[model samples]
Target: MNYTELKARHRSERENYASNALSLRLHRALSWLNKAEQVEDDDSKFIFLWIAFNSAYAQESGQKHYDTERERYIAFIERLVSLDSEKKLYNLVWSQYSSNIRSILNNQFILADYWRFQSGDIKENAWIEAKNKAMKAAHTALAHNDTTTVLSIILSRLYVLRNQIMHGGATYGSGANRQQLADCSALMFDIVPLFIELMMAGQHQVWGDAAYPLIEH
Candidate 1:
């Protein structure tokens, strides 16, 4: 389910759909996914993939106060898992990428609490406790085939990587983060396409309106 194949499928089927919001989201997400496939740099590839993921999941709150970005995407994951009747996502997690997923979970640099502790905003024990707690929860979720929970935790770590790159927190082409970048990009390369395909398959279900939709003059 690469971009080319997914686009062909969308063109063949999308005409019957009524929601412009989903159409727009798939368009944006697929375009970035196409760009990601062409780029050679790990940082560029990961950032582009994150944008694609964001395009697929992001939505407007339609109110002044909105859910946090974490909440918004976690909710999206819940919807995705519910719609995944064949367990494609769960099998992808458990069968194909379990080791890669475990490595990402254990990387403290990608944990928000680890950074807080590093900055002295939190004590060492607090962040360590938080890290252990998160790992235990993820391990339990994986054992139970909890697709939504495991996917949510994986994306949380990826979001930390996204922030580091998007916010100038990482040195360009730095050797230190290269492995993490490569692993994250590899995971996303498979996952984002499935996400787009899943959304296309479940278009009748309510996916809230995409944020910042297009407007004609």
Candidate 2:
């Protein structure tokens, strides 16, 4: 239906699913995504999309020293990848979205440059190295530490951009900043639905039969 009607329906759905932190966060993210879609200005779209990304990313990253719904989701992804049943899905996601992920990571220019310098350059392995550096920065930036493996750098970079904009270090409209906003908006357009799907999967994995029911009253 129309944007207003869709938003109202989503709000109702969110109210039904607000029993847990994860559900609440998912609904909030979706609401922001809807707003992002409706906004006319690139800057406004960027902010709403960033908010959407941040809401989902926070749920996925969780807090240090605590078992989170995201942890369970990761575990589930690991299992699926190992079993080959979900390998194609994972591969598809990576192949389709990895470039946008890298774009977001590179927006954290200082961190990205440092990682590139330290990692050394191999022309053939540029993508691999970029992924490595992005992962490193994601862990450092988000978890405030180091990680050998990259889990969610894509989402983490969005978080980084959100911080830059929210902290007033970066302007949202015009010139280079405008392009940055555009890039993030495009990336969010691709990933927001995926993030929502992942969160829904996590909810099911963590809550089993009691997972948030998907129905309308």
Candidate 3:
């Protein structure tokens, strides 16, 4: 959506929004997340970005943000109901922490075989397990079945790339590996923005003009 133009438009408003201590943190965080998205290669970064964005959103609005955000997603509905620990909305705060969940899972899956292979103990099954769990958690948290295939494939591809980075080579063969790498890059760059919309209640996109998917659930 012409991020440069939009950022220029909101620069003054954001600067004014930053005058308050909370908004100030949010302003800094929005900038940080923007930068993180540009170079983020791991789940840790996504986790950090999600936390920063979610906190900023919470501070910017209120508990209602959680509800509205949950309503936008298919799976988070039940989780949201169970997350209102502060009794903010309806005693459901789990959904409130969904972003954090995604970040952790993303990181874990990405490191799958690499962590073990680096330790000189490459258990293919273990790697598969980690990748599987992360995919299930991520897709489940997203609560959208349509994306299950793409997200799983993309996440696995990214994990494999990290695996290669850690091992300095490829055991999954070159052609397949390169294809997966390209797919992973596409998935990360393309899907992450839609993900942000689903995760943050009021956060705006910084990269594109894509419309949110029409979710019925």
Candidate 4:
């Protein structure tokens, strides 16, 4: 295809991908939220945010090296809403998508607060700045450069899924990725408890003069 045709095709693909992914993420997020409410562990919720944040960050890297990628998303969304008055779908998509994005930022905010409480050196403003990064990443994906926009759109779609688990009503054994989502949700519940045990073990080793074994001994 010619350059113009190629760009058009590419733009179409990205739009569809973002829509589908955002829809799926909403479903997943809702399920997880349901599960988290029933559970007694706070760590599970935190870990879900952390792992999802990492996942979102990983996907966004695709936009970093591209150009004119961000514009396509803006144009596409504008055109879509203009063509359809079906605000419900748009709201659903945007709510689920933006919510997922915000959840990671929220997670970071919470973690930064905890770290501050524990005497870590993070400043409150610094944490907000760090959280803003995800937004910047999304905006970067929506840049005028077509290439970067495409990549960022995909990353944004992925987070739509992550958001479902964090803020949406999610639950165990509900609809999930079967690998990443299902496994991650299960694993999230266990990580904090597991970490506490590890810390305890390390403390024992320190007192016993175990020499703080080289790596995770």
Top model by lDDT, which number? 1
* Model 1 weakest 10-residue run by lDDT: 59-68
Candidate 2 TM-score, C-alpha based: 0.54
Best by TM-score: 1
**RMSD of model 4 against the true structure:** 19.4
Q: Pairing residues by index, what is the TM-score of model 4? A: 0.24
* lDDT per residue as tens, model 3, 5-78: 33454454554331344334434445645665565444334444444334333332332344544232223323
The per-model lDDT (C-alpha) reads 0.87, 0.53, 0.41, 0.37
- Ranking of models by TM-score: 1, 2, 3, 4
State residue 133's C-alpha deviation in candidate 4, in Å: 2.7
TM-score of every prediction relative to native: 0.94, 0.54, 0.35, 0.24
lDDT, candidate 2, 1-217, per-residue tens: 2335544654555544525565666666778888888888777887887677556545333233337544544543343334343334354345544565456566544233433554574343565566576656654543432111233455444444565677786765656566556666776665455555544544433322222334558
Cα distance off (Å), candidate 2, residue 39: 1.4
How do the residues 11-105 of candidate 1 rate in per-residue lDDT, one tens digit apiece?
88777656888888888999999999999999999999999999998876683344588988888788888888999999888865557777788
Query: Model 4, stretches more than 4 Å misplaced?
Result: 1-95, 109-118, 142-217
* Candidate 4 per-residue lDDT over residues 132-161, each given as its tens digit: 665565555434333333324333433434
